[model samples]
Target: MGADYLKEMFGLEGQTAVVVGGAGVLGGALCRGLVQAGAKVIVADLMEEPCRKQVDELTQLGGQAAYVVVDVTSRESIESLLADSLKQSERIEILVNCAGVNAGNDFLDATDQDWDRIMAINLRAVFQACQVFGRHMIQAGGGKIVNIGSVTSHLPLSRVWAYSASKAAVLNLTRNVAQEFAEKGIRVNAICPGFFPAEQNRKVLTQERIDNIMHGTPMKRFGEPEELIGALLLLVSPIAGQFITGTHINVDGGFTAAWF
Candidate 1:
């Protein structure tokens, strides 16, 4: 009975989810969680190879899955992604924006190209995706959207200036968009993850930086990609998260808490 009740509240059976950046490590984990909860997942990313691989893995796990190649930097590409995703499912019930980039440099050394690139992927793309997908969801009656944020969303981190700034903007955007869509039965929220090793930030994680992160994190350890699944599920689940919106959950192993 307990299991049944839990499933009743959290199960995603018959839903459809589109996870942008679904090929990356943390994004892949979010996709897996959505699929396991019984939603048909559409893996959207820039590379066909990784998207295909992600679909194959999700299929192996007995989940319905498909892939759509998208360059989030382009608004037209994101619209195409929506069209392609609808080909697999009648309506998308959830959207997770997980694509991001990061670079570390002294304030004086930061390049315009790097800043633009990071903002394009990490902030602008999210805004575009939300607008595109939010329209679909509003027409479909209701849906959920989860934007990927970083611990930097709440507190500034050293060196990765653009990344920190973009993430902070993402969280702000999430709140504003949430308010816009609230009356439309669409809930928008964010998940701010602590340091999990991923391709985007690997170049920035020097030993000194690692030590500093550990010192700040009360858990004294880095989070695993899988550790974020619980919060993801909560924010996306219709029954469990129906009243939750316009806010963010910090899955940062006490990093944000320690800041206060």
Candidate 2:
């Protein structure tokens, strides 16, 4: 606490951060973390209430914030979000893609619609948000993007075929964007989370699912929304993760490492 190496390295004094899907659990935690770092936040989500709640809470805490209803599945929504943020802040320094959905299905039972919808919300949204916001970063020198993938991207999780594939795409897409944008100063990275309470899997989060997750995770515990804050900070904070890009930070409690 004396010097706070992390603080020194990752202070977001006047930066503006956009958290897509800021209403949900993990997204809300990220909003708070960035707000605490002194970044003005724009909470974008599918629902207005949740988005407003996030903005209000941050404002109550004396942090700057704004909210907009965004359908990550739409290019227009994504474009408007970036346009509005720029109009308001003149600059956007961070973009975090936390909006995603799980396509619940066995690999063999998965339908084309199921796969497309999952990819649209999870994988495609990330790309849309990046391109829309990335243009500004490219114009203004540079920016940082932190995309949320899943641990399943690396390890197959049954009954979520499309979800897993979409996240896998996200991981690869992060690397590709990082390589293309590195010269532009736009660093791209991803966070592959194990599990947490959120809207993405509300329908599938049963006791059986919880037990299955615990069995796979070495820690035998599901992650908390707050647990993601540190990793997110390390990635988006310009000084902290300046050199860290094109990598996926797994916050899954060693879920991918345990086999036995």
Candidate 3:
């Protein structure tokens, strides 16, 4: 295929993308990918410093980008993010819900607080973000939303009971929302990632757990942060992903395919 043909299919020139949780590792990579694809990116997160830092990084890379402080736990806060995004870029063409939290605890030892906190950030926040962004997209005629799920979304893992349940809910919610807005020119989908160590998961990635994950994964290794960008670009591209929705892509290194 010609370079022009490929660009035509995936170019995001003049588009604006809002990446919630863009301050963190995986989210930061997604933000950079969006920028590289020619979209003006808004790096939204809970803290100003890190969000601004991401914007700086993108700027240094010669990409159009900015930052917005957001607290995804609140619907009003999410709405404010949408408002701020519009004010900065005129419109939002894509939304990536990457803000999430996890905890590792035995099933019997999982506390109500743990479950509530995990669900609040992982599931409820995605719901609120989708509703807020989905409404705007419907009114604007079209948009793309990519929610972050996990390997636990499909398979049960030792510990992380609340995290597993929350991610599972995220996957289901993605489908339901995708179907709900299919006729309205809005696409909702998910990316279920396997074991990729980051700040959020470091607390849980003990030696024993790492050994188990490697054994379960066919590739016998963890995924690189940048490895997720291709799938993300495909789902967010207006031309390439026009008909794709209500589905998920598992970037799990065959972990979901492996069984002992």
Report, for all candidates in order, the number of backbone clashes.
0, 0, 0
Task: Please provide, for model 2 over 1-260, each residue's C-alpha lDDT reduced to its tens digit, 9 standing for 90 to 100.
Answer: 55577577888988999999888888999999999888999998999888888899999888999987899888998998888888779899999999877756657876788888888989888988888889989998999999998887686677877777788889999999999899999999998888887776777787888988888888988889989999998998878778998998889899887843
Reference-based lDDT, residue 77, model 2? 87
List TM-score per model, in order.
0.98, 0.94, 0.98
lDDT of all predictions: 0.94, 0.87, 0.91
- Which model, 1 or 2, shows the larger lDDT? 1
Q: Which stretches of candidate 2 lie over 4 Å from their true place?
A: 1-6
In candidate 1, how many clashes are counted?
Answer: 0
> Candidate 2 — which pairs collide?
none
What TM-score does structure 2 among the candidates reach? 0.94
Ranking by lDDT: 1, 3, 2
* Candidate that scores best on lDDT: 1
The C-alpha local distance difference test score for the whole of candidate 1 amounts to 0.94
TM-score of decoy 1: 0.98
| Candidate 3 per-residue lDDT over residues 1-260, each given as its tens digit | 99888888999999999999899999999999999999999999999999989999999999999889998878889999999899988778899999998888888987788988899889999999999898898888899999999988997777887888899999999999999989999899999999887998898998888999888999999998899999999999978888999999999899998853
